[model samples]
Target chain A: MDYALNDFLMFTPEVYLRLFERTHLALEPWFWAVPVAWLVMALLLWRAPPRARRLVPVAMAAGWGLTAAIFMLQFYAPINWPVGPFAWLFALEALLLVLLALRVPPVGIGPVVLICWVAVLLALSLMTALEAGTWQALALPGVTPDMTAVTTAVLLMAWPRRWRWGLLMIPLLWCGFSVLVLWALKLWWPLIVPAAGVLIILIATFWPTSESPDNA
Target chain B: MRLPIRRRHFLLGLAATGVAVRWPRTLAGQHESPITRAIPSTGERLPVIGMGTWRTFNVGNDPVLLDERARVLELFFHSGGRLVDASPMYGSAESVVGELVERLDRSDDLFAATKVWTRDERDTRAAVAESEALWGVGRFDLMQVHNLLGWEGHLETLQAMKAEGRLRYIGVTTSHGRRHEELERIMTREPLDFVQLTYNIADREAEARLLPLAREKGIAVIANRPFQGGRLFDRVRSQPLPGWAGDAGVSGWADFFLRFIVSHPAMTCAIPATTQLAHMRENMDALYGQLPDETQRQRMINDFQEI
Candidate 1:
């Protein structure tokens, strides 16, 4: 049986909420899935990988910790910003992913661009948060996270400059997909997982390791 | 007579049926309310209380996160729910929904509904292609003009796609307060299978024109924001949930609001956004109880508005 501790928490909160007729939106509520997946990915990565493996988990942890802290602030005190807390927190986490990806070999201009994007995102978020007298006023802003690019960039920057240039092809694939999906769906949230999964697969598939699956 | 050929073509959707309609989840133990509507363009019996993807399911670009979301969907299907509605406006909701269906290896249980929100014909076509790609389905049960954006451009493209046999249903959507008269005119003009609009306890304006017109026009209604931006929850705050609500099988504000909308003869479903999984099950569960008759409905209206 899947021990649904999150479900239990989510489900259990209702027992008391039922007493009050009000719709109790549990602010600062945890989405057990985020941590659940994070740790799972971290465990897998720690076992695999170059020296960056150590840095990856640490950056992810810091990213999550800061994101959590921001959420806590937003939950207790509302902010008046253009974006939601979720989006801002997500950008922060994406920043960590860029940092973590850097520790692994093959850090490239893509990571730099990403870090820059995060910087801009942070600046914008900071402006919004500061403007909002209460932090709760901030909203989730628009930030599309495409891991294909980062993964492709990693492959490209890995040097040994052979036909491995085909590596960047993966992100090109995701880019083509994002164009269709974003245009068709009019939203970016659905791409989150398949893209991440593809990134993980590419990371494992291309790594200069014994476990790499042969394409041929 | 022409419809038979079309129906045959659709039934030739043997591929789709094999892929789309999983055997009902509730067939064994539970008794379900038997209210089915024929797709006017082609006679298909779709259960009215369909599922919607918005806040809860849309977590774009995160695969591992999606794996966990799988259970929410498992519950939806296991509970005998079908007819999933999504749109581009909802931000990856459709894509995430599509991904989940694929992961479940159970596209057979879905009545996929999605929408386009672009103005240009190129953009509209691009959107439809993306919808198909993200969801991993070759066709859609319904594709609507999200909030009526560039609807003229998108509607023409949808009409063309329908003619080409890519989509079975063409529809439109609008949210939160609108020029109902204009919406009515659009509904009258379009050969729409469904039209999604905001209708809730607080936003009952749809009742006056849009809904009556939908009933007369034979267009399906999808109620959105059934809680009216969570205000209904606030209004019902601290007050005791009426014992009668419990009798209707509603456990929380989400269900109470959803049931109220679906209880209407015109509504196909009420799609509420929730990020958490429990909310998904709770909202879909509202389908189990007795639909409020006119008397009880009016009583619900009176009490709700008074509050």
Candidate 2:
């Protein structure tokens, strides 16, 4: 009936890292191309024509959906039941991204926001390679949960002021959840740095002055 | 050869009286007295050592891991294990146990115990049914309210189910020594047949109140987290088990740890889960041989503390 305290502490850093390694191995040649594609997409977001800029949310939706479908629902949910609901949350986040993408392409994301996204992507990739051992086993940026979280955070900040806060909910909530998990599992340094970005956004922003569509 | 000799005598008895006399002494060691304890409510005897399916048995639809766990169950039953405890919270564990028991055709001997852990009365009813289906047991031997969640609502349903003969016993559980005051309150008020709680030698908080309360209330106690989810092993991994542990017939630290639990007079069962065959064998080995007396139980506590 009751869980042993240790049950909550299962999947130490080594075990969690192995999931990424196995996922990478399973995903293969297509997986190898994901990081390159992610880099190209981030660069395009900066100076791409409005037509190309519109594709950002579409690509971000695919990232969230893939992380949910492949990483969370398929791999992680079996061992960690808490992730089962989270898989659906990620899918819903993807749906939200689709809705946003269909709307007009907003004023381009600020240079500062794009820089933070790049930092999150690089930091996560470096940490995955460092901790998991072998750069070859690194998680694809934008295709893994940490990267998806960062991408969502950036996309939220770039949205029209009305849509930004509601859209940021999932990624911010995930940041808090990941902090607890990563802290408990003692995967400290990488999580600590990337998590600071969320803190910065929290400091700079206030609660929305106008209600979102939920009120409508 | 032994069976043939017994059969010849039985046949002679049957030929004389036209009634077959069953051989009482056919398997000598098989009758070696197993350590068992009395259930407080019905005075039924149950083996003191039981199996827990916590994180250890949560493998989901993996045939290879299922086979590995099945072999562990084989060793458990082979060593006189009877009670196998599980819950819905232990992801895929109930279904895994159900599949293993059905595949091995050993459900008859298993004492199935699980819990309902939802928030509402309707959800609790649905959860129990889901567990029954997952475990493939038409009825559970014992059903407990997990972590005392929705205890009032689920306890009502469990009591009703027990009266209707759907479950053999009703109880509640908690771990990490959380909600002890609330648990004690319920224990005093409810007509529970069992109370599962964390009661390892390392975490002996239950000894102060819950164990004594169970004794006074005539409620059977199922001790969980007996090894503290391998924390005890981790503690003594480097240090040598005290030489005096041999006096209590402890071949390894697992036996030392488990025997310390089952030896407690109030402990009806101690469920320790392990995925490895050797560890399961080690756990079951504690079931046989000598258990420690009060003096020795204290000695174990002192020794563990020293380590």
Candidate 3:
């Protein structure tokens, strides 16, 4: 069907941004633990790559589940009918992450790269939260879909497994979807999501997989 | 030939029914009743200022937003507004309007209008049934073929439903200045009570053909996107109204833009959608006092162009 970008989005930017605040309030107090857990996991991944390999994906899986339940189902689905399928897509990504956790080999990712990834993800989350005009509406990794997808894509780039492309599919699709929605709403800051995804893909494709010690 | 007799009877019936309400004076301080136009076919008078549920009323199931929107609706009805337009394509808007109308207990005054928007020809009846269920109105005052999607099948079914007393009126709609030729064709060939298209001071393409055709065909023209999807407000945010605007019953930009459309000789109503109660009040305010005549409408066009 021939449709304009405006046709796909039925809510205004004000209503769209308010979703974050409402979601945060709906899951209050307990919501604080989500970012804390994500921070601890990132610290472990940066400092101790070997031990954190299996744990990181599992934590990310849980984040995907939470995003599906809290954000997609509870908040977004009402405003956008397609969000119901998006919630299921999130659940599928969660399942894929769990599978990755089970099968992932112990790979060594350098501390510098890991820390940079952590900082980037953290900055993106804070930027999104601040745009909503409140810290409580923080779009934390492993809690919200955009940050969680970007974090997963970047993390998978560190691993040189050929099958990692399979895990990257949903995250990439979601990033593209987010870009369209944000662009339609005239929200420029959140465009960093798909930009980061593209940058990571380029880096992962060009970087010498054989020479990198992380491949071991 | 029969139009004058029908119009006379319609006016007499309106007097007998006493359905019209006395609207307050315009912001320009003019003493005039709220502007209402009679349906060409039935001569039922509808207030010219209608509400639209496009991007504004799709608040989902949020209680806070629902209440906020209820207040907007309360102000609309209080200001003598009616003829609320919605469609199945607008997410949760139909349900939200249904809920608010039920809560406010103003269904009797509401000229409930919604659309059938499905690609499947067989789904036309089902879509209307679903809208009826969501709106809790038993039957819609007007059922339109949204964007003319599957209009051929939907219009046929809608005509049957009207005959069966399940629908009061049937029409087709298009927006953003799309498919006017097809819209004109439908108006010429079919017995439509209404035809909604994009019409505003900024977008006047409909004036060349659709509006004139509607006038000739005796079809009520519902002006959609009267504010150009709220872009007109953004454009004139820093600009001031013309000094002589009050003479045309324009107190603000909302009135300036809306009165231009609803003032057109062919227009039956203009539906301006807004989420804010203040905006709803401003939109409803356009209903009062004198509307711009052709010369003033031309001046409005010139003024907006300079902005």
Candidate 4:
């Protein structure tokens, strides 16, 4: 296992990723691109079908978490191969996307995908923290799965089931608290994004649900 | 042998000759010809601190990256920068710079220059048109036969463009150690506005023939590979800045290195690539002062080797 871990982390691709990133610092503009990409995704989500709205976040969270896990696994630990429970869940999400496209989840499977993908991301976040000795770099938005999963999950979980907005407010509060922690750490734009998401969600909630599903 | 735009690729380098009309005085000798000049091809003066669109800038239009770089170019304009050189070989540099400058609403500030790399006249026209479409410019200020690839055919087209005013000037470029002989032969025969070649304290061969020929022809020279494909940087870094380097008004090793190229009478500006704003500012600073004289240039060479 030690042999496997050493060689795996020390592989050329891992070294290349580290060097390419360090050499270019291409991520510097992520301060702007992240927000811009968000605006694009948000615009994309605003007009997409309920199923697309639901699956998009779920797919995003799953993809983001899986990519993060892959990075940490390649860097800190070794995942050796790609067959596991999360792999199975991702397969299930893929299947769900097809179903959602067929209009299967009307209230939106935003909750369903959120629950599955966020669990995976949090698990990876935990493993990455355990392996790296510190979570300093891993606490940022992309470093974890889509936090939009949490927001969409909150709305989906709270609304149709008649649960008060308070029930969903727990994760919302956690999101808020994480931003505060990040800010105190002088995390800069890393914390600013989730904080902005908080404002957008608060504003979005006051918005009426007057537009029901056209074909629902 | 085939420097086809489809396969023949090269990184674009920055040059001088703008900022005459834009900002306040300081650049008293800024060349007017955008790239470099032979003699009296003079018109509106070109800025010496122009942008080179290569590597990542070669990627065809991504509105997001374009928007960010637009601000960078806007900053470039505010600082009185003018030349922007691109090539069909540089993927989409010509196009992206065009779209970028256009969107920034400051396309007029650009002294646009590009290259023809393909082997056939038909491919040459197609590539030039693509560059025109990419940048939305009707004509290019300078169009060179890139790398001397298909030089016979492309040079004919460039000659025609000159006659029709589709191009303002013509030039040629080549790199690496092997091409020096072929590059030399082309230099002796061609009427070129600018001859772009590799020159640094490290690669001293070009100084023997190319530089002298350019001086004799009255052709302007563009020095590329000022850092030897960035290998020069790796060699001298982490060492203390030479004591006398500061006496030259150089703030960093970049100016220390590039000014050596600029100081040569046979040379024009040397273009070095940097995405970092700090590095860009340092590079632009090289053009602001008097270049090194012969004795100082020799010392610059001796110091570089010692490091």
What ranking of all candidate models by lDDT puts the best one first? 3, 2, 1, 4
Judging by lDDT, tell me the better candidate of 3 and 4.
3
- The DockQ-derived docking category for candidate 1 is incorrect
The residue-by-residue lDDT of candidate 3 on B1-307, one tens digit each, is: 1111222343354357652333234323444568899989899999999999998999877776776777677667767788999999898999989988877777988999999999997798899999999999999999999999999999999999999999999899999898999999999999999999999988899999988899999999999998888778889998878999975557689988888999899999999999886677678778987788788888889989998
| Candidate 3 residue lDDT tens string, A9-90 | 8887777777777777877878788878876765666556564657878888898998899888988888888778989999
Put down candidate 1 lDDT per residue, B1-307, tens digits, no spaces.
0111122343355346462243232322277663445555566777656666655554543343455456567656666677888766555567678767876666888888888867665698889898899889999978988877888888988899999999888898877666566778899987787888888877788888888888888887888767765557878898776778777655766767776788888887776655555666566656665677888788788877777
Better of 1 and 2 by TM-score: 2
Per-residue lDDT tens digits for candidate 4, residues B96-204, read 6776676666667777777887877668778788778877988887787777898878877787878888888788887655477887877788777777777777887
Task: Provide the TM-score for each candidate, comma-separated.
Answer: 0.55, 0.77, 0.90, 0.54
Q: Which ten residues in a row have the lowest lDDT in candidate 3 chain A?
A: A207-216
lDDT values of the candidates? Answer: 0.56, 0.76, 0.81, 0.54
> Model 2 over residues B120-178: C-alpha lDDT tens digits?
76687688899999999999999999999989989998999899998999999998788
**Which ranking of candidates, highest TM-score first?**
3, 2, 1, 4
Docking class of 4: incorrect
Query: Between prediction 2 and prediction 3, which has the larger lDDT?
Result: 3
User: Each candidate: RMSD to true structure?
Assistant: 17.1, 10.1, 8.1, 16.0
Model 4 lDDT tens row, A75-124 = 21221122133333433443443443344322432335445544543443
C-alpha DockQ for predicted model 3: 0.35
Candidate 1 global TM-score: 0.55
